[model samples]
Target: MKIYRIANLAILSLVLSIAFATAACAADNTVPGWDPAVLRDASTIKVMTTEPDAGEHWSNLWVVVIDGQPYVRLGDRSYVRIQRNTTKPYVKLKVADQEFDKVKVEEMPDMKDKVAAAMADKYWMDVLIRHESHPMVARLVPEAAPPETPSH
Candidate 1:
């Protein structure tokens, strides 16, 4: 009887642990550090991309935070097509596994100059401070309508 009880408890613990791990993985699959509402409501955002000119470095762009908000950081020298096209109201955003539509672009004044400088110093890489002059501002506008039928 003692062995049986101990075995039962161990199995219970293992099951609970597995359940917790599965939940964590599911959460991780979504954008990190974002509420679903913010993702749906945000009009502008930064996008992290692979810099074609940097030879294996990441680039950041001002983009629409469509669908859902995910964590994003843009470098000073990112692409401009997405920003320019937003004037015609053509934009999209990919956050995690979801895609956002109707993103707008806008410029934001420099608020992270000190932080950027510090990071550059630590990494020993040069980062441009005149990011605003580089035309790096953009906003993302998501559709307001929810799906008529949500998938179960």
Candidate 2:
């Protein structure tokens, strides 16, 4: 009975260690093109979207980070850009001095509430804007780096 109790305590310790390790790993996994420290604190970022006819359209807008991923909310005018992104997910993001090219933009309707909450936390204006604008939430996924060629 003493041995069984010790084994159970060890198992519990192992499980707790794994849980803490996973949480730490997630905290370290910062979104690309964004400095982890600034992602949640920066006021705005420059986003360039490809327009079907008008070429690249650039706009500086508020960015929110949720679960280590970067998201942006678009109003009626910018919402059209999100539709355009459905076909061409490629986009450019400028966060401070860092610029990320060819990043994929995916609309995340399911994360609207979460993104809005993050936005409200970051910006006081969002408290009022959230009520006035029916915004669409979109996630920015970094483009995968190209494979390296083997030198002969």
Best by TM-score: 2
lDDT of all the models against the reference? 0.43, 0.78
Deviation of model 1 at 33, angstroms: 13
Model 1 residue 32 lDDT?
A: 33
Model 1 alpha-carbon drift over 4 Å, by segment: 1-79, 83-87, 110-133, 145-152
For each candidate in turn, the TM-score is 0.33, 0.70
| Winning candidate number (lDDT) | 2
Off by more than 4 A, model 2: 1-34, 85-87, 148-152
What's model 1's lDDT at 5? 100
**What clash pairs does model 2 have?**
none
Candidate 2 minimal-lDDT segment of 10 residues? 28-37
**Local accuracy of candidate 1 as per-residue lDDT tens digits, 1-152:** 99999999999999999999999887563323335554434444333333335323223332223234322234435544433342344345554445554333344434244334433443333355334343333334344434569679
